[model samples]
Target: MAKRCVPVTVRWSDMDAFGHVNNVQVLRLLEEVRVHAFEDLRDHGGPSLLESGVVVARHEVEYLAPLVWRLAPVPTDIWITAVGGASFEVGYEIYDAVDGAAGGGGGGPAAGGERTVYVRAATTCVAYDLATGAARRLSATEREVLESWTDEPVPFRRRSR
Candidate 1:
């Protein structure tokens, strides 16, 4: 699947005293991107990816570099990595959008510049029936919808190479 990228603004409050984005704020950034993804699917008149009784079961994040304030919005890429009976995994790659290099953080630094990764993360979300308060299997329609966003799996570990 093609990567879905959203531009995210960095608020003044998002910066820490150290003059960089706080570690926790990165999670908020991820949340913004995640919500945007689900809302896009929801707007298409399909099942609500978020409102239809879905809850985050796990969130794992890795901070790769410090993100300083920038006028341009940060570009975030999010996609589905895994789909299971009652849960699915959503992955995200967040990085500085500098020098018009949006979504370019995955690559090495430019010859005369630097493009840094702010975070690489994933969330496992479980589908639940609110009334029953239990996990519910994904329906065929839901699975199909989610599969549309599925992409190549992202490694959780940082490679030495």
Candidate 2:
């Protein structure tokens, strides 16, 4: 997949006492990336589903390694892994940029290289009518926005869980 690069800075406060980013910080980082995605959609004159009461119904992340505290400029890649009728999933990978300065490596920095993180994850979220508390479908524009990010054919829907 051709992943979209989202270069971001790490806040000093994002780290925990261990001098590495806390596990919980992954959720926050993921959420930020998702929100940034909405901005991309909007810039393309696409619809954003964030305000439509689409909440995370599922989240699955595999913590690969610890991220020691750093000054700033972390590179995080984000992409639409899948888009469903009332839900969608996004994939993320947080990488340290130092190892990438010489410029070349996929996902994280070179194995065991400094300035790289190895954590990655995927999350699924669905839209619902806040007033009715029922599933709501995505708009055509939103669907287009999702498809713009990947070569994967759109996924078929299943009964809501």
**All candidates' TM-scores?**
0.82, 0.77
Question: Where in model 2 is the C-alpha error above 4 Å?
Answer: 101-117, 151-161
lDDT of each: 0.81, 0.71
The candidate that wins on TM-score is 1
Per-residue CA lDDT of candidate 1, range 1-161, in tens? Answer: 55698888888889999999899898888888878888888787568877778888998888877887776788888999988989999988886555454455456555676545678888999999888999999888788888888987766666434
lDDT of 2: 0.71
Residue pairs in collision within model 1: none
Alpha-carbon runs more than 4 Å astray in model 1:
101-115, 159-161
lDDT of 1: 0.81
lDDT of 2 by residue, 43-118 (tens): 7787666666678887777676776656655677788888888888877777755645324456663555565555
